[model samples]
Target: MRITKTLWNKASAARLLLYKRDASPPSNAVRVLGAMLGLQFDFEEPDLLQMEHRTPEYRKINPMATIPVLKDGDFTLAESHAINLYLLSKYGGEQKEVLYPSDLKTRAVIDQCLFFDAGMLFRRLLEVSQPAFIGKIDSASSTHIRNIEEGYGIVETYLESSPYVAGDRLTLADISLGCTVAGLEGINIQ
Candidate 1:
């Protein structure tokens, strides 16, 4: 059933630390980072098949109606990318310098990879999955398949530049794309 309550607000009640309904790729990326940071989350499983994210309560946590809303203390943030970066910056402790170092040039490279993942790679994956998920098609079309190849071409270029997308050492960029690439593979991108 669709959530009809329109008066619910995030400000009224907020004690949740983390809300992840499943092991979706986006949430998994953050989960990987959280594991590296040795952090434990307060998980609550909800049926995505039932569209729980469309509920008023879930919307209060993430207006985008997405999974894996991070609520650490008074800070309530949505979006896995933002949540991952914030967690690394705030709670990374010693691992902060290694995973997401504050260096200028390295950080720029990491940022580039993140942007590429968010814009091109992830978008291409969505083109295929969204339609299939809604029963618009049985599988990805040739156009969507070509788009996925184009995304992989970009990945190839990044790998050619260095062993990792960001450089020698693994960074948050790799984690983001790792999850996205896994999604792409789910749609047979590879």
Candidate 2:
């Protein structure tokens, strides 16, 4: 829980659009941001904006109509990945080296994992698990099970190689996949 010393010391206003869940992926993003910036999040679970990204009022904050929008001072950002990176770069010091990396080759490996999580791993999990979470998709269906299984197999294969997804040292990639993918285990997906 060692957050950024300078970031914690600075007085800043922070707000996030998110839901209530222990393992909510966005919360992990916020947690990572807090760790990166060393600042406590002024979290607000705005009911009016809850999943109402298309509303005109909400569009002012993020025209893309995305959840987990972040507002700090005059700046606003959307996309958890982008926000996490921004926080780390702008506020983090030596710790940024661990999360984002300094070496080109090591950074590439982390980038690969982040890309896989955002582009493929998470997409598939959300597709199959969406139904299960919302009671729309039958969790026991062979197709649903297979989809989850396939995704899990892919992650497990990679995890078998390293203690974490991106390798020995934990990175943003682990934070992303760990919170999102690991939650699927509730339905025995893992």
Candidate 3:
């Protein structure tokens, strides 16, 4: 099923299709960022547990079979980080531009932080989660807990100098990292 929204400016507005998971932190980040930018998008939720994302129809949209896929008109893209960057670049106005600065240095820092979240923080969480999802483990092991703690320590150090992850101002890095960190709630890592 698909739900479309007609924005205020139809001529300039592009139809956005977002494949998301309701409980997914990455998906939540995309939804929050879109709302902040005042961009309307259609949403489709595919059940990963039920293997819905593995179906032919879903695979056609994203060969990687990942949630948080974004389709703008005919252009399809997977990965939440890439989607957030594209959305901001395409729809962000002057006021919204601060979220992802045009300055080369600032943009680089934001990109670095975003990569850290993807490669380090979120990766650690997934290591713990994927095993539990398939009944490989009843709970996180000592090593998994240590890894999560180490990731948190890195985040804490990064936050020491600024309120947000990248810097003082809110950026795509913050949205991405914030959502990834929020996923730690349900896990018994404590």
Stretches of candidate 1 exceeding 4 Å from the true structure: 1-16, 21-23
lDDT of 2 by residue, 120-182 (tens): 766666676555656675655776668767777877988899998878888888887776676
TM-score of 2: 0.78
| lDDT at residue 152 of model 1 (Cα atoms) | 91
Pick by TM-score: which candidate is best? 3
TM-score of 3: 0.90
Q: Which residue pairs show backbone clashes in model 2?
A: 4-38, 131-137
Relative to the unseen true structure, what is the C-alpha lDDT of residue 57 in candidate 2, on a scale of 0 to 100? 80
lDDT of 3: 0.83
What lDDT is reached at residue 185 by model 3? 69
Error of 2 at 116 (Å): 1.2
Candidates in order have lDDT scores of 0.78, 0.67, 0.83
Ranking the candidates on TM-score from highest down gives 3, 1, 2
For candidate 1, the TM-score is 0.85
For model 3 the local lDDT of residue 66 reads 82
**lDDT winner between candidates 1 and 2:** 1
Best by lDDT: 3
Per residue, candidate 1 scores C-alpha lDDT tens digits across 1-190 of 5532122222223333677744366788888887776666667765676888889988887888877788877889887889998888766778889988889999998889888887788888877776777678887778898888989999889899799988999999999999988887788532
